[model samples]
Target: MQDKTPLTPRFSYKSDRLKPLRAFCQTVRLGSVSRAAEALFVSQPAITLQLQALEREMGVGLFERSGRRLTPTREGQLLYELAQPLVEGLDGLESVFKDKVAGLDAGELNIAANSSTILYLLPRIVEHFRAEHPDVRLTLHNAITADGTDLLRADAVDLAVGSMMDVPADLSYAPIYRFEPLLITPPDHPLATKTKLELADISRYGLILPPKRQITYRLVDLVFQQHRVPYTVALEVGGWEVIKQYVAMGMGVSIVSSICLTDADRGRLATRSLKEWFPSRSYGVIVRKGKYLSPQARAFVELIQPDLFTRRDYDDSGHSER
Candidate 1:
């Protein structure tokens, strides 16, 4: 019989070799080498070199440059789809394993949330999280939900905490709190005194709303259209505080999330619940589908909802291949 000794493996099992795979995954996800470099905390030239090495080894180009953009080629797309989860799984393995086996002694948890959420919603939750896991470094990226969603997709942030009206298929939202929509007006506005308020009545007055580009504006617009009520936007402002100030100054009436209404706010403005007219706004934790939550992230999520991770079918095994 002929000798049946196995030929040498093409790729060595050195851990550093996997760096190129990670570099390729991030570059494709962000669609630019520079952004990928920033995300990976490496130099742009380093990223480029890694991609070049990967292409040379695979014998196929992965990206096509068009102006400032890098579009993945067909081969690149196939590689990305196959490699992304594997890279993420490997990168997150240590954190996942330690989190499952040892108590939360140390880890980094990055979160994305808007200024409003950081201001109003997360203070207590953050305080508790800090007290519980003093060793875990927690970093919050201030971004609106729309921008936060993009950050989640890129794996830039571990998760997002905010309100989402339209959850993309690739992400999951678990609401921890629900706040009624409120019609905020100065104490003397005509609609404030009416014991029973109607949608048409509110539509009659000019409204101070968030910028038309925001999801809040879209929700407001859709509600008005559904009621066949013609509404006027008096001012397109950005922040809830600024909009509230505008309403108090009598610029226009506005609808806002009741979570923004505090005891201090009650003294300055009159709020009538719009639950009769509009759906309650929900605030929740948003995460990418199939993401492996680090122990620190899982701890914070559990603080929000005791069984949220389990209900979502998260893999809790310390050595899970997934």
Candidate 2:
């Protein structure tokens, strides 16, 4: 038979307690016991007591006081660094677990979209849904063609918005818009002075374009390839906003979605249709094969779709059509 002895305290204080560790970390981060107390919604004396308890447990002074200012000592710095991550991680874990147990607050939603969709479509949708389902949190990730598709395949995102290119066999999409790309030139540029130009005529000047990874870039490439159009690309930007800025600077001419150009932008740049370019791009939503959607995600999709696909203005005869 083995004899059992009662466990004795190895340190001067209880090692299992988290309150002192948390208070010490908060004090160090905020730079004062009183400030930490205010932030934590505790009294100043309570903060002091926790810190003292922590220092006693460790058998070392954690902080040195200079008048009203409290600075961490060498040992305090080590302990502060060690305690901070654990305290924060535990707090986050607690919140997540508690929310899980409550059943009402469930999980998060992840959304991915291309640049144009994020800037043009998502804002109004997010705002409309957030009014009611404020408890659900959402993350939005934006990328170009293959990256966006990869995000969907990897299940990194619950929803995606992009040009309705070749969708994966398992996935589904709803076409939102069929939009023509407009040739853009800054108001001050010489090209802006021209009336009704063809793609061949515009190819003479330097062009600012999106990178080949983008769906718009792929469409542009297809157009040039089909017509055997030879052109000089002065810049290849990764983002649509950057392309717009470069065009606005009169650096080069660009082709972009006409809808992205607001009434305010009309004063800065000029847009004209290239009648020869017959191809139009389709933008739409992409969802996973068998994935279940949260209520917030479903609501967001509905709100944005109406704006993109279903807007109707009647004629004098009370008729509407594309």
Candidate 3:
């Protein structure tokens, strides 16, 4: 009646609806109910039941099995797109609250980067972060592109700092530094003093390069193939430092990024710009597509470059975070 009785609530007050939403979102996120259960510290059957309740409440089929993996239905994907941010925000609430009250005093951050980045790019940034927030714990994992991407997808690392050539849809990268490609040779090498150089000129000498699996080798291979230039590898080893050392000893010449060059190498290695032949590599920060960055993580990332991930566009440059 228009009198004292109130209408029934649209939302069920007897049970918390968040549990079901969390179960559904996690199942969709992980593509496996068991994995979702493990991630959420719940039983498999409980996750299954919550998912069932959520599907029934929404009156739609949410998942269909594709071989061993659970694939979300069209409606389910729409629901997931709408609900996942809510779940992540809710989950990160405590971290956000702590950040507001305590700042970066006692949080932790994990980052993944390759050896070169760790050696050259991160030292200053890391030192500054440590100086500003002494109580915050920071860990850096040495990882290449593939390993770093896997770590981000698994939520094992808060972010990664590296260079990427092809950005996948599920990751975000923000490039902060641009370095040119350079040809490095021992000061006494024949090509070091050549006035006019060409690809053929460089191909005349054996090259000290990273392994075939690394992008540098692949890029060198592609460039040579495109120009129909034949070349030999004097050594196929990893690590730019090692490559530089061997190049200095006249083991072989190398094409390397300028980031690795320093005043220390000027006496031993002759440098020539190869930017015309090779694309400039860009290095930056990487984060998962839908990840909610903790305040500690955010502070560290912004410390490097304030403009990254401003509008939450992951892989904004459509390039990988290598």
TM-score winner between 1 and 3, please give it: 3
Listed in order, each prediction's TM-score against the native is 0.73, 0.60, 0.78
Off by over 4 Å in 2: 1-106, 306-322
* lDDT rank order: 3, 1, 2
Write model 2 residue lDDT over 1-322, tens digit each, in one string.
8768877556433555667777887787657988889877989998887887777778899898877888899999888656655665565566545644753344567888877777876777778767756777878897775787678755588678777667753456766777777888888776676776667888898889888767667777778878898888889887767788889887898888764777778788888776468456677777654334444455566676645324332122211121
Q: Name the weakest run of 10 consecutive residues (lDDT summed) in model 3.
A: 313-322
Candidate 3 backbone collisions, by pair: 163-322, 164-322, 166-320, 167-319, 167-320, 172-315
Q: Candidate 3, 55: how far from true, in Å?
A: 7.3
**Lowest summed lDDT window (length 10), candidate 1:** 313-322
lDDT of 3 at 218: 84
How big is the positional error of residue 274 in model 1, measured in Å on the Cα after superposition?
1.7
Report every candidate's CA lDDT: 0.83, 0.70, 0.83
- Candidate 3's clash total is 6
Output the lDDT of residue 239, model 2.
70
Q: Put down candidate 1 lDDT per residue, 106-206, tens digits, no spaces.
A: 76889999878888888988999999899988999998889999999977898899998887645678778998899999999888899778999998899
What does the lDDT read for residue 146 in candidate 1? Answer: 91
Error of 3 at 292 (Å): 2.1
Find the candidate with the highest TM-score and give its number.
Answer: 3
Error of 2 at 235 (Å): 0.4
